[model samples]
Target chain A: MVTDKHYAALDQVLELAVLINDDMTRSLAQDGLTVSRTHLLWELRRRGPSTQRDLADALKVSARTVTGLVDGLEATGFVTRQPHPTDRRATLVTFTERGVRTVEEMERGQQEFARLLFAEMPEERLDCFSEALGEILIRLREASRLTDPRGGDQ
Target chain B: MVTDKHYAALDQVLELAVLINDDMTRSLAQDGLTVSRTHLLWELRRRGPSTQRDLADALKVSARTVTGLVDGLEATGFVTRQPHPTDRRATLVTFTERGVRTVEEMERGQQEFARLLFAEMPEERLDCFSEALGEILIRLREASRLTDPRGGDQ
Candidate 1:
């Protein structure tokens, strides 16, 4: 049985995660972007141009949601959809120069935010924290897969 | 300098966090509730009734957002807003019986989801993962305080 202390700890993690995401979203919003949009841009920057379905899969969002996000980004002149190199039915979504700059700015902000957050922690503790987070993340990912068999199979 | 491996691990943590939140949101939506709304109900159920500003602080959302959410909850007969006992300018929000049931259902879903997610992991590894998550959570909370001085101060 899960104890109250365990529940409290889980609640703290959930609350902190929400707050961190909110701050990141607000920071990105100041640059005329939402976290979702920033994430798409970041993925493109990291993995090069990808089709809409590929992005939807990677982001774990529905294809319709991805289409709407792409439409918004395109309207903002941050991305353009070009014909896929080999698939006639597929379209490759590439970032514009503006998108690149925006993503870089967002990345810089995130890194700075992270650095400031960790500035007070001892280096060893920071290392521990990072490692611990990594382990939990792996567990959570594996767990999420089991709960969503469709997600796991994909 | 952060090693490439460490950086990769951090990226995995970040991605997994997003995915988990998405999964939770979808799960909550299936029960005719959004995570944000259910969060308020859970808070009230755990901590008793609270003012809008207090709820906002606890949820790390803006007061305006909380106001809208409360409005919707009140309309759905899941919550009630009453005058604050001591603060004339504030209104206390509490969960109704329906609200409590809703929160309980959401919690059950979440716990089951977590159980499914970790079923495959060795118990020892699960404990380690939980401990690591707890440590990182503590550090993240401390770090967030430094970056946002106004957070939790109100």
Candidate 2:
């Protein structure tokens, strides 16, 4: 049986997730970027060039979705798609110099925002909260794997 | 100074939030609904009815976005928009019987999914996890209010 406390906690988790995403998305949009596009750029910027399939798998999105996102990024000159070095069947995506700069700016803004968020909480509570959130994430990822085998295909 | 543990926890929290939302959105899509649209319908079904602006506020979306969503819902005969009884410029949105039934089905599926997510964790761990998540959410929300005065504006 689900207790009231459990229900309340779950609800709060869901709400917080939405609010945080919304805020982040808004922040990115203020700089004329979408979170989805920024996510793709950030991946390339952080991990160096990678194949479309690999990028799709890392982002947990469909290949077609990644293709569309890459198309937009390529059009904007933020990313480039080239033939993979060894895999003729796959294409490699890499960030442009402009994309790298944009990602760095975004990272700075995000870090500042994160610092403000953590600054408000008690140090001990923040530590405990982080640990608990990590544990729950592990459990949820496991549950997702069991129920949704499609992710495993990636 | 942030410890390695803090960084790990933060990354976990961020990744978990993304995965859970993705899974939930996919689950809702399988039922021919988007998470945002389903949220509007659920709120209407539960609260009896509301205006587009009110729904937008409750769902944390823009009124223009709500208008588009409501238009799609109305096109599918899932809901109806009528003039507010006392406010000529405002409109009230009420879910149709079909909408209510669809939302109830969605809720049932979500509840079952949540149950499966929590089933593997021990009771004590679950309690600790939930409490920690709740505290973080509260602190995040409060911090956001301080940093962004328009954070929750719809």
Fnat across every predicted model, in order? 0.18, 0.32
TM-score of chain A considered alone, across all candidate predictions: 0.85, 0.85
Error in Å for residue A145 of model 1: 2.5
Clash count per candidate: 1, 0
The TM-score values for the models, in the order shown, are 0.72, 0.80
Q: What is the C-alpha DockQ of each candidate?
A: 0.27, 0.41
- TM-score winner: 2
Where is model 2 more than 4 Å wrong at Cα?
Answer: A62-64, A74-77, A81-91, A117-131, A147-149, B60-64, B75-77, B82-91, B119-127, B146-154
Error of 2 at A84 (Å): 4.6
Tens digit of lDDT per residue, candidate 2, span B1-154? 5445555666776787787786777677754568778788888877787998888888767899999999888988789998999999999998888887888787787676667556556676667667666666777776666656565522
Query: Among these predicted structures, which one has the highest lDDT?
Result: 2
* Residues A83-152 of candidate 1: C-alpha lDDT, one tens digit per residue: 9989999999998898888888877776665554444455655465566556556667666676674666
lDDT of 2: 0.75
Q: What does the lDDT come to for candidate 1?
A: 0.72
